[model samples]
Target: MSTLLKPEAVNRPSMAAQAAESVVIVMAGADQLPVRRKGGAKPVSVDLLAALVEAALPDGFGGVSRIGFETAWEAMAPETRRALTDDLTCYLGWSASEKRQAFPADPEDLVRYLRWLEQGRGFRPATLTRRIASISRIHRMLSLSSRDTLPTRAAMVADALKAARRRRGSQQRQAAGVRLGPMMNPQDEVEGVTLAMLFSVCTSDLQGLRDGALLAVAFESGLRVSELAAIHIRDVDPQADGRGILTIGKTKTDQEGEGRYAWLSVDTMRRIGAWLEASGLEDGPLFRRVGVDRRQGRPARAPQDYFSIPGHTRHWQERLQGRPAEPPLARYAIGEGPLTRQGIGVIYKRLVRAVIDEGMVELEPGREGDLVRAISTHSMRVGLTQDLFASGEDGAGVCQAIGWRSVSTALRYVRKQSVKGGAVSRVMDGLRR
Candidate 1:
């Protein structure tokens, strides 16, 4: 990405300083988007900024391949960015210590490093590929003139990749389903969890409303946990027929940034409406932090969701004139900050257990444990996809419904579900007659 040289704020000391004998080249484009404290009051020289931009280029990335643009990098999921960062850090440390140079542009050095990672550290081929991508990123930081001086060794690095399949075949651990059959709420109450029971025994407060709504929406929508956490108040579009539409602005699949929409079931919409009314939500992120304050005697502030409503912030400000806002005076309290993806998982597990506590269904001794193990932040998405496949939804229909970008992804989801009332399996059963 063309480094925006934002505020010339050096996030941290770069490897260049250590390798280049303390000649500091500010790493261009790190955390340029998020407004932060400026690096220093003194303005940076144009020459230094130019050097930083040059130093930041990956090895073979030329000006023509859109590698210089930051949009795609910025759009990556937080987890992906963090992994890349870690991989790069690991490579730089190893290369500096082993090769006597921190950043190596030569193809031979890159290959040796990969072998070291594989033979010495026992890093898997998949991990090696990720590290290679990171190496490319660091290479891009070097000056364009330096880029030409070095050979375009990226292809050779790719050729050097160890076969992942032979050494350590890896696959994502698929989440287990909460239920089967057409999407339905809990039926009976006897030590099993379901959406109905979870909602029924909710704390009867704002958090309860939100969690219940979140659970229902997650099950109905089949959203990835991160995508679900990213939902905004304005994304919900109500329809005349009681059903609603949900706009997913960004997802892993949407490379072009043109977002897609999903249908919101009538039942799901009702829970969401209840949550909106209870929280006084208006516009902004939908899910947020909700908990009991550690201190005593404090009602929660109005949710930021209500900030768009006229007089909403003013009304609250007027109520507590000079007083600092405290947690709810009552036992429970909620906050306006958004929940991270991890928090979403915690909430899901808590609600699932709550369902079990309410005796939602008669579970055999080990069945509850099975359900507990199966249910995760990803369970709803997996369960919904499986249910759709089990209910005779074709591959194309399933992908569209589940917001899957490819038929292959759709196929992977239902592999385990294939035997559970699957279309071809059901038809094949008739042969026994």
Candidate 2:
């Protein structure tokens, strides 16, 4: 029994040790790990580059992806590539919002998205159309064919857009009627003078200067507040022989595409000169807040200081003292750069309030009369157009002066004189005679 047990147990521990050693040696024979470069940075992938391009777009709602898709689609058509590129550049430059976090997953989502943009963002009809067009372009690009109908789900959306546009046109017509609001009462032409007087009576400080200049320019040049606010020092050549040319870079219809040069009248030139001289403005934002000290009110410092940012304050102060500073003449009077739509509204409201307070224009409650009840900044443009038409200026002349690309847009501003007591019927009776 002892002999049998000893034979069975022979080399069992040695055999197990040999098996473990073989396994270890096999594991060690596997592929060696790769070595990293000493100094070279890892290159970004194409997918990442595409995503980065998408991220760089300024307009909200995956504008970059839309643009990328458009470009990729355009590559198939050599003729359209140039136009597409130009359009993309313009779109990116004008868009105010950053690219959206996500894109619409479905066509219905796109429709809803557009509606949200219109309602929440108060996108103008033109702007809404542009965004829809962009989305349509993206869809076409993704489908890899121009023949595809704009997302079927967007049909209702399209109808809604059309309806909204029609409604907007109707509302604009009604608003234009309100804006025209009866000819300056035959006897109330004196109201213009009264309005001017009201502005004069407000105060003779910086605020007053701004108010006066604004009114003078608005009345004389028939400029919208947008035009007024956008007037740069360089835009006005004071040495142009008693009449300065205003190079309007942008307007409600033009969007700063091709600038229109309009002649400024003598009175407007004088008022602008007065405002500039009194405010000591040579360059930069033309209009700025007049700082009020505890003792001195609206000091006649350079208008440049009024618009300087906090970081540039010290530099401006030094420049003001006639000392050398970084970016010379950084503290000169520069007019307000561009007036936002909201800012134009606010400025008009304030102007109307000032006019009403002074009793210059009678804004009778509930009586829609020739007197302006609630004038908006756009009223200036419309009013001026009406005045020009009434004075016998043609559509082409008005279009040229106001920076309108289309005659139809100018026609919107030119209202037909309202004939009283069925003039058409009377003409028909004459025909019978």
Candidate 3:
């Protein structure tokens, strides 16, 4: 597990500060449940814990949830907190390893780290900006000289951020559009890959059924991969009219868990049903990793991985290092657990590329190669958003359909698509008048 030794190598408090005493800050490891290191009159000081928390937490715009401090830390998902901790720890290690300065990196050295991350490490400008904020928080909690506050080098962090922007430009302003193309005709292989073409090739088999259902549902819902992976079978309720409602139990937008619903088409509902029937899953996660036993016949049921979530008893990463003989799953059995966020994207990419190789996607003359690399798990969501805009659906209405908390986000998608088709660009097209 990634850890930043408290400045001065101070030991961590045995327990966390009580609610009455102070705010809770989680310091969970990959292989264990979060041990509450409460602050009191103890060997480990509260100041050390504060440094660790400050190092791990996000303080920049839209970093933390908009919810109040009452349960905000608790509301911050363990996975998210863990990720921040890892990022912060990695940065500190780099600072020391490079001999830039001491553990609490000096301002002059931080500037070097920024440049190195961009040019040497190949981190984007946006990521560089976030890292600077994290570094700033570290200095605040550790009571060290801050790049932002030091009078001699005040605006040093700002200068780094400005340099980052100059290097790569604004990331949010770039959202590529996905346009529909000819659907796959089984006999005649389609060359250009379209969302419809890709979905059509995924048949009603074990893996195909799951991929088809997920693609269709994602297209209709426009959910992030995390939201899609979090979906449980119980959350889906089919309506008598063929359309179904999907209750997103949790999301980045609805951090409070005041669940929202997104409508799915009858087609998507049917695809989901097909997968469910084939998998023999009564309940639990709807999307799961496919069993890759590669055995001859259908095998016995594999045991459910109960201790496989946050504090996984047998964390995959650790297991890999030791090199176990047998594979994770002995036989082919669908999991009762949800798919990992990374798995969703991996599956989507694999399926799309599979169809592309099979000549199922018809493309324009030379764009086939570029198109394959471009389509992401989000292609379905982006395509749907673009389609909605082209079909004249208003921003507010689209937001409601897609379960977006704000119409502003939906507007960005619309605006992005609009710019591609903007009249101003067309006037200067070909020969100028």
**What TM-score does each of the candidates earn?**
0.61, 0.53, 0.65
lDDT of each: 0.61, 0.49, 0.60
Residues 1-433 of candidate 3: C-alpha lDDT, one tens digit per residue: 1111112211112243121122222222322332223431122222333455444444451322223322333555544554455556667677657854433456677777788888988888877877766555445434455545642244685688687888687665333344455322222222234667667667534667788778777777788777888888888888777668888877776777898888877677777777776566667788876653332223234444445435555555543344323322223345545666556766766766677678765666786557656666566676676677666677788777776668776676666456644577556654675
Q: Give the TM-score of candidate 3.
A: 0.65
Across 1-433, the per-residue lDDT of candidate 1 in tens digits comes to 1211111111222455334231211211322222323432233332333344344445564433334435445656555655655665576666657753434456777778888888889877767877776566545544333545443345666566734435565455566665433342222111235555655666645567688678777888888887898898778887777778888877767646698888887766777776666556566778876544233434545444444546745566444443445532323333454566767877877777777777766778767767777678877787677667656678898888778878888778667546545567568767865
Best by TM-score: 3
Q: Could you tell me the TM-score of candidate 1?
A: 0.61
Q: Rank the candidates by TM-score, best first.
A: 3, 1, 2
Give stretches of model 2 more than 4 Å off. 1-105, 110-134, 137-148, 152-154, 162-169, 173-202, 218-227, 239-241, 249-258, 293-344, 364-374, 416-433
By lDDT, highest first, what's the ranking?
A: 1, 3, 2
- After superposing candidate 1, which stretches have Cα over 4 Å from the reference? 1-80, 93-102, 105-129, 136-163, 179-201, 294-333, 353-376, 420-428, 431-433
Q: After superposition, how far is residue 275 of candidate 1 from its true place, in Å?
A: 1.7
lDDT of 3: 0.60
Model 2, C-alpha of 23: deviation from truth (Å): 95
Say what the RMSD of model 2 is. 30.1
